[model samples]
Target: MFLVALIFIIISYGMVDSLRADYAEKWQLDFQDPATPVMEGIINLHHDLWFFLILIAVFVLWILLRTLWFFDRSRGTVPSKVVHGTVLEIVWTIAPSFILLAIAIPSFALLYSMEESTDPAITLKAIGHQWYWSYEYSDYTTDSESLAFDSYMLPESELKEGQLRLLEVDNRIFLPTHTHLRVLITSSDVLHSWAVPSLGVKVDACPGRLNQASIFLKREGIFYGQCSEICGVNHGFMPIVIEAVPLKEYVSWVSSQIQI
Candidate 1:
């Protein structure tokens, strides 16, 4: 009975978070952008080890119950009078070391991939100000125009239908799909963090310093984020939105904006 209840609790917690996440994905998604394959692999690693952990927990529970039912001192059971043995000692040590190595090897590979920026097709620089985000496309240049804009949060009354309350920005950064774009993040006023969970990109925006990360969007979508640093009262109002589109559409957007 207890085990069943424990399982229910676990299922409830998992389903609750999954449901909320699904709701966010359905209602809040302005576009369809799948998670990167490497991020999916990282999640698989977590699932694999968690399965082992659950197995270990079940095994431990069985051993405790067996001892209580038939081998306890109160049941007049004989204590295992055996002492240390070379084989048993070696088995315990070697088994755990192997498990640790198995988890560590892939973990390192994923970590390295997250920070790797090798000859990216484009680069975008983000600057965190008092409350808004300023973006400049460093990869594009022209004598007649430049792609730089300040993105501010849209007022609730001014927001479009189905737009998120605190997650919509006036000027969303646009990037082409299936392109490796490097982002350099920094702050002009204080500390802030640039994070969009689906893209698995998060880096601190610190003043007098710049941090970089690479993002390769697998599909076109509207990814939302907020100014993760509490700079001031309006901190809650500064939202970040990125509209990833096709290459041709992205170029047309640049041309349309620059002519204005």
Candidate 2:
């Protein structure tokens, strides 16, 4: 079993650099490709923590095997002798403390970065209903000039060609790439969560209260997410789609909506 695992690890290590996924797959075990700075940092921190986790697992397994082999009745004719070394105790305690410290530094940094909003170029408000999402642009001075829309999931039979069943929505949120965005989320009736895996955002929308988060998209693409929190019978029907475009295209889209 150990030899088989060792061979598997060796093969996987060689293929690590070549294994890249740009989007989510049907049976994906890894994270969807990150499209924002915060998501990139999340991926990096995940890898860093996994390195320590694997190291600790391997060390613990080796110790278990060694103890079994040496302390077994078949190998030892005499009773086991008690041994306690202060250096070993101290080393174990201090080593774990340093490892936790190393892990904490990056964890705290990512949390702070996720919450940081600096001179937002755009502000988007997402209101969650029992089964749909409504968005509003807060930049417009008047209600008539502002853009607002409700995104409803398309029925499986209504989905067009190439559209993902249960994932397609009539209206997708559009944002400009390489721009700072402040998103405020709130629930109208029940609790809901707005999440996008590629963008690494998941904020709960509680009733009568607003939760804010910041996003800085680094690339242009179509990203999909679902309402993570269960609100009602149609909770699974609410899906979130974000279309990231160039600044010029984004402005053109807003203008067209305003004119309508």
Candidate 3:
């Protein structure tokens, strides 16, 4: 039983990298490939943290088994009455503070990178409905007539052979790779959240309020995610499908939607 458990854990760990690679292949923005220095740095730091946690867990488990039997109270172990050790308390607090700082600095840099903007060539406004998504371009003033569309979840029977359920949409949002886009997201009814893990974005869609975020797709591929917040019965049906295409293809797709 122990051997079987160990084998399963090892196999699962080995597949983790492949799972990440699959996401990369399916959703890496055309210009924002995994090879970018910014994303690569973040992924590497995440890997390091995972390594640290796994090593600590294994060491602690080993110590528990190797010492528990020898230190059990029934086996004559005595309790110590040292409840409040100021030095120990201070040490634990300060160590965690340093550790958090180590994680925070890199995280803040990535955040700033996402927020940086010189001049965005395009803008998209996303409206979250009870169970659908509406997108408007050119400040959503109708005069721009840039492009507007509603995206509904594709029904199970309507899904393409390779399309996964709960992630398929009727009209997937299209955007150009290597371009910075400002997305203004708001809710039509209740609160919802628009999140895409690959893009490292998660922002709330508030009712009657406009919230914006910038996305710079460096790669070209399809990325998928669903409404992250529980709004209602159909919340699970709200999926966001973004296809980052080459500049030419994206522009053409936008033009095609304008005719709709």
Candidate 4:
């Protein structure tokens, strides 16, 4: 009865609204709703693995309880001297091997899919600084035109109503929904990480190395993230905001930026 109730609670937790960030909720119990295809795939894989985890946990707990109940001092006067059976050993070994194989197949498929970024429509170069992020939009403006900007964390005092403290930024990276994007990440100083949980993006930013990742937006919304790797004193202040919009709005935003 307890196990059934636990499962029901988990299912109810996942069914809650995922589009908006729930600041008041606990972290370990829920996953922020996914906005991208990669995030969706990740959520699916996590639920798939949970099934195996629950099965193994229940089996181990049952074995432990059975042993304590049947073989305790109050229940047994003499210890059994039987050795391990060959059939039991073979079954344990083969069953685990098959279970592993079942897990590996889907794991490999998801890994390969992440690496497969075909024909990207836009490319964004993100350079990490000691405590902020700068981005350049490629494939939109010509060589003479400059389409770059710095994104700094908005101080708590400047944040308006409903804005998240330490998570909102002055400038947001914008992109169009249903478009494939290639993001090149690097660091100007120490090591940093470009991470956003909703987008399923977490690429390391090395000083002299360029790391690439793919992002495909399935919907239009505001997504937030922070630096995953600790680089300096204000690492927590470096926030990332992505404003995904429609294609027409995105083009207009580009034109306005170019004009500015």
Give TM per candidate: 0.79, 0.88, 0.73, 0.89
Counted clashes in each candidate structure: 0, 0, 9, 0
Question: Model 3, poorest ten-residue lDDT window?
Answer: 16-25
lDDT of 3 by residue, 1-260 (tens): 99999778657645432222213235644323342334555576677677767866897799899688877878997757789999999987997788778778877887787666547788988899998988877643345555677999989989644566677788878788888778888999999999776666678999989887877777766777678889999999999988777999976876666665
Q: Where does the lowest 10-residue lDDT sum fall in candidate 2?
A: 14-23
Error of 3 at 91 (Å): 4.6
TM-score of 4: 0.89
Report the C-alpha lDDT of model 4 over 1-260, residue by residue, as the tens digit: 99999777656555332234422244567666788888888899899999999999999999999888888998656767878789989999999999899989988998888888878899999999989999999776755765999999999999765677788789999989999899999999999999988888899999999999999988877788889998979989999989888999999999999888
> Taking the tens digit of each residue's C-alpha lDDT, what string does model 1 give over 104-204?
88888889887677778888999998888999986656774457889998888897544567777778888898887889999998898887766767789
Using TM-score as the yardstick, the better of models 1 and 3 is 1
> So what's the TM-score on candidate 3?
0.73
Cα-based lDDT for every prediction: 0.77, 0.87, 0.74, 0.86
By summed lDDT, which 10 consecutive residues of candidate 1 come out lowest? 15-24
Q: Name the candidate that leads on lDDT.
A: 2
* C-alpha RMSD in Å of predicted model 2 compared with the true structure: 8.6
As a whole number from 0 to 100, the lDDT of residue 200 in candidate 3 is: 62
